[model samples]
Target: MKFLLIGQGLAGTLMGFRLERAGHQVEYVDAPEQTAASAVAAGIINPITGRRFVKSWRIDELIPAARLLYTELEDFLGVSLWHPQPLIRTLYNRGDLNDWQARSADPGYSEYMEDEPATGRLPELTQPVFAYAGVRHAARVDVATMVAAFREKLIAEGRLTSGVFAYDQVPALLGADAGARNGNPAYDHIICCEGWRARFNPWFADLPHGGNKGEVLIVKTQAPLLNLMFKHRVFLVPLSDDTYWVGATSENQFSHEEPTAKNRTFLADRLAEVLTGTTYEIIDHRAAVRPTVKDRRMFLGTHPDWPQLHLFNGLGTKGASLAPCGSQWLADYLLAGKPLPEEVDIRRFNQPLR
Candidate 1:
């Protein structure tokens, strides 16, 4: 079957690859002005989350699937993108240390937690009054490179069109026989992966999209190169050379997508608390809106009224880990006859949306 994919962000890119691999043709249409959260994302996949240190939702399923998918894509793209790095979580206080020990004893955290706290791992870093713990099987993906390479490859293969997708033209363009093969290219279905911009999409505008603006910084630090991700409040992920991706300030309420001075100061103040011996220079700053849902779950499945229209978005901040499995599931449902898991299906919203 031939498919038309709107937006070449992480979700659409992954889904397009899956559909093509499954013996289907995919054509992509994306707007140049679209703010893709995937481009600026840190792509860090952490199993444990929050101050309470509870495991992420369905992390067991998400992490393993992510490992397999990224490893495969690494070989396919012939680029080094996926890096499995340990995460060193700093213990802020005695209470934090106690909670870590308690959770470590639980069998559920066996695969994710370290056997002991890494107290002396970084002597240079300010001696935490409490302690530090290591998380295993944590990793990062070079999302920006992956997205650019995929987009370029699609464009080269005559599968991508670069321009704004006028929604009004869609109905007239796809008239009569949905899959009819004519001189002009026609698609059997059009899947919307328009990220945060989906809130403006007439078809999916009603899906309760609560877009959050996130800001991150790329900095060159004099600190010694480390293979593990350092996290306290803000995460410092090592890239190549002496540069690291430092950031992510989550502002649920923001005026625009532009980087703000307030967030920059916030990140710098927090980063200073973690890096005692390291001198760093800010190299780049970026901001984008994450396609977060009000309920904090992914939005998936076809339009309620339009059978030929589908949506596969709302992976939010966890796009790297979520997209791998989510895209494959969407492809399977589209190509095969599998039913979408109830949790992610858009049908859960019973009220009419404006």
Candidate 2:
């Protein structure tokens, strides 16, 4: 089927790639006037999170698919975008280490923790330091690189149109007689993947969403952290561009305004505590809201009124690990006439939307 995809962010890009690979033509419309949260994202994929250190939702099913997608796309684009790195989660205090040890005894953490040794190389803050291994299989994707690669292919295939999509322009239903859009009219169906802006989308305003804004920074470090991406309160991702990413602050309180100096300074100060002598340059600062569901689950599946008008969003803070699988699922459902798993279906919520 010929599909019209609004937005060229991670969700839309991946879905477009999947449909095209399945021999369905896809037309992607994403102008610079668009709001792309995927562009500003740090793209760190961690399977375990929080002080309790529990598994992420559906990590088992999600991680493998995401890796496969990255590999396939990297080969297709002739670019090295996915990085497998170590995640060193330092224990700020012995209490933190003790808490981790207790949690490690649970089967939930067995796969993620390899070693918990005393790495004295860290800062000797008031909180005693203990070194612990994080999910080494954790991955990071270069959002800019991946987006460029996908967008390049879309451009080459003549599937990309540069411009923002107003709510009214998106047809709310698929016409019955429409075949693949390449012949005459543009598309058989339209899937909106505009991230947090989905709140404003009349097509999906009823889909329960609690917009979540996050801020991130790119810093030029003298040398790579190379020790997997480190995390305490903040994350540090190494880039081929000789920069490290430190972020982020998940704020439900703020607007989707420009990245503020306040957030940059906050991240920088936190980063300084971790780096001993590495001089860094503050290269860039950015912010965007994740298309979060109020319940914190991914939002997918078709519209209540128009099944052909689908949606794929709500990755929240974990878009790197979530988008690939979510996109694939959406594409499979669209092309092969499969069902969207119940958990992510927007119908699960009760709302006319407040």
Candidate 3:
């Protein structure tokens, strides 16, 4: 079967990899500068979140498969992208500490959450941190390297187009009986994975795509606080020896995805207020809009009127964690004619968000 994937972000990359591995021919069209959310994202995949230290949405089912996925890709690309580092989650005050204790009492919570403290030569945090640090099993992938590797892999095999592609350039699917890529017609079974750019895709653009403009900073923090990616609304991911990624503000109604000095200052101020760390220098700054929905569930499944057409975006903040499982399910449904899991089914929008 011939599949046409729009953007080469995480979702598109994983889904396309699955399809291509299944012997389906895939030719992706990507506008790199315009569609590089994977490059800017601090792709941490911790299973615990929030002040209460609750488990992430689907950590149990997805966690096991995630390591294998990234490891396989890393070996294939010859670059280590995925990281299994601990996260030091600090408790700001008394109330937050109590909530963490109460939640930890539950068996469901204890497996993934803990009340450990910061150890080793780590700098003293202003607030006492009851850290739930662990190997987390999940790792942060170097999104840009993996994207470039896959893009090159696909292109070298004559499966990629490196140019801006307008929607009309996509030919329709050959017919219902056609295979995914090489076996059948492509124009018919197009799945739009354009990220925020999906708004411009004539076919799936009408779907509700609330935009979140996120700004991230690439900084050189000579302080080698390695072994984990730190997160507390803002993330300080260790990039190379002397680098860390401090990011991300969820701003709405932005005119463009370009980085703004105002947001850069805002991100710096936010990180500074949290931790008293070593002096840092901003190396690069970028911003991109995530194609999100009001409910935060991704838009995945065939279009209402066109079963052959599909959509995959809106992992929101958890694209790193969710895209692996979500894209696998999408590939399964697409190849085996199985139903999409209820969580991400596009038709479920008609049902009120619980």
Q: Please report the candidate that would top TM-score against the real structure.
A: 1
Per-residue accuracy of model 1 over 1-354 as CA lDDT, tens digit each: 888899998888888888888888899999857678988998999898888888888888988888888777778777888899888888888888889889977879977887464544464754454567888878998888888888888888999999978887555445533434344537778899999988888878777887889999888867555667888788988888688898899988888899988888888888787777667898888999999988778988887766778999898889988898898788878888688777788878853332
**Lowest summed lDDT window (length 10), candidate 2:** 175-184
Better of 1 and 2 by TM-score: 1
In candidate 1, list every pair of residues with a backbone clash: none
lDDT of all the models against the reference? 0.82, 0.75, 0.74
> What TM-score would you give candidate 3 relative to the actual structure?
0.89
lDDT of 3 by residue, 154-272 (tens): 87888777777776544434344322344445554677787777777776656677778898988776566555676666887777787888888888788877888899899988777
TM-score of candidate 1 to 2 decimals = 0.93
| TM-scores, each model vs. reference | 0.93, 0.89, 0.89
**Cα RMSD (Å) per model?**
2.9, 3.8, 3.6
| TM-score preference between candidates 1 and 3, better one | 1
Sort the candidates on lDDT, descending order: 1, 2, 3
In candidate 3, stretches whose alpha carbon ends up further than 4 angstroms from where it belongs are: 125-138, 169-188, 274-277, 350-354
